[model samples]
Target: MITKYKLYFLTLVVSLLLLGCASKQNFIDKSKSITKETYTYHTFENKNKLQLDFYQSINYKNTKPLILYVHGGGFSGGARDENYIKNYCSKMAKNGFAVASISYRLTMKKLGFGCNTEASLKKEAFIKASEDISYATKYLIDNKKKFNIDTTKIILVGSSAGAEAILNLAYVYENKILAKEFKYAGVIAMAGAITSIEKISTKRAIPTLLFHGTKDKLVPYNVAPHHYCKKNKKGYLQLYGSKAIANKLKELNTSYNLYTIQNGNHSWNSKPMFVYFREMISFIDHQVLQSKYQQKEVVKKISDYTSTDL
Candidate 1:
């Protein structure tokens, strides 16, 4: 009887060991699917705090890079993880990047752009929107240790109005404007425009990759006074068309790249969208931040002045 009892105990111990091994293997398998995480963040509406849902990619391996996304709704309305960005975000996250889709305050016309003449008030709200994005990113960074992530290597992605916020976040940090806490390696902007083109044309931060369409009727292909803001003449926004803007960047000698989708709509998500993002992820994996190239023509004013002195 004593011998039989000992054997039973030994068999139980072996079974427990096998279960432990299975758990370890399961962990290894999950590490490969970090992009499947989705989460929500909190902010305020009229001084009252509220929760805003965002889809966050799970970091199974704890090593997947991160990309923070801000969805566009003309600066007024849009969910953080719209279906448009959902699949793409998942594809990116699953491939090895933790992605977050964020929500921000909308404009008065965004079911609420009131008739208040206080443009500053409206702009302030926009500023708040940017703040929310910054905070969300910072939250991720602060918890990097818990997540086993490289907090320093982060990519910011946005579309349309959200792109505006991301660009502003990049360029305005020096001005102490938005997202002062996070680090960004690069940017992927789709149909984005800066609030102040003069500011953007004169200075920039990280390398920005842009994708825009010629017939885009929303953000316009150019700056104000010519933005496609008005369908009648395709108004002034045409100045932002990738080619025109690329020329400007060329003149500025900023290290940037562009892919102008022929007659591409405001945000084209069809052609191998996943594939395009994957390629960019690889690019970000290897690129280092550096001084942007200034085009002789764009910076010719400064160069000309220096040359005259010479």
Candidate 2:
């Protein structure tokens, strides 16, 4: 009992919905085809072990980019094989990239990571984590030919404490542990910061994608003390977070993207992997793999954000 034009409009809407569903189903099928391989990459002098969970597509080609991911646990406790991380890595793999999620030493596991924890200990934690990442990178580079991956396209992705480690290594700290000529292709830091913002110079400026919440209580969106500790506290260490780092990169005229979440909390550490996957992939393709100079800042309020949408 409908007019011809009204029926035509209805048919078009139904076709569009079906097309969307078909596309989503295709993505799911591709995601299911990812393969994961585990490797014991390093062993400490104390006989402690570390491992890497390498994820790739079943039909992965040669010279594909690699994403090295570090999990967040405040230098206390976090596993590389967590379900969320696995899912995230799987998605990246489905996109024709190799992903390596690594395990590092939890130096602060025994001594809690709190205001009572000394700043020196916090610094040591960052150094230790970065060292582990360096070793992991070296292992991948050494076997790049075997894995058929392009070592030059290796990007670092981390959350919270892990983000701090990667950012610190990318800028503030020198990698005396790795080969002198080696450098990470880019960095994706989620709620991350660095110990010294001044250390990030033109030479160290790489393609960077920063995701941070303005209301992040642990890591500051700008310059602030670690864990918001007071000046007299033992763990009072100043950190330059995402906003500060992005501003530095802007001053240096480097390629960077800062996605600021207004009133968003530290939970954004994992949300980007799920919600902003396209942005991450775009950065890898345009900024890291190619020479794309984009200094973009996206600010979204919490009320406007939902898990289902990009």
- Superposed model 1: Cα runs more than 4 Å off: 1-42, 45-62, 109-126, 173-182, 201-204, 225-249, 269-272, 288-310
- For each candidate, what is the lDDT? 0.53, 0.85
Show pairs that collide, candidate 2.
none
Native RMSD of candidate 1 (Å): 15.0
- How much is the lDDT of residue 239 in candidate 2? 91
Which digits, one per residue and each the tens of the lDDT, describe model 1 over residues 1-310? 5453244334434533543443222433443444344444554556744233333344244454567877777666777655556665655554445666766656544333333224354455556666777777766776777555566667788777776677666654343422445457778777765545445554464566666655666555455422323434321222233355556666676666676655656654233244255346434543422233422211112122232222
Q: What shift in Å separates residue 38 of candidate 1 from its native position after superposition?
A: 5.1
68: Cα error in model 1, Å: 0.3
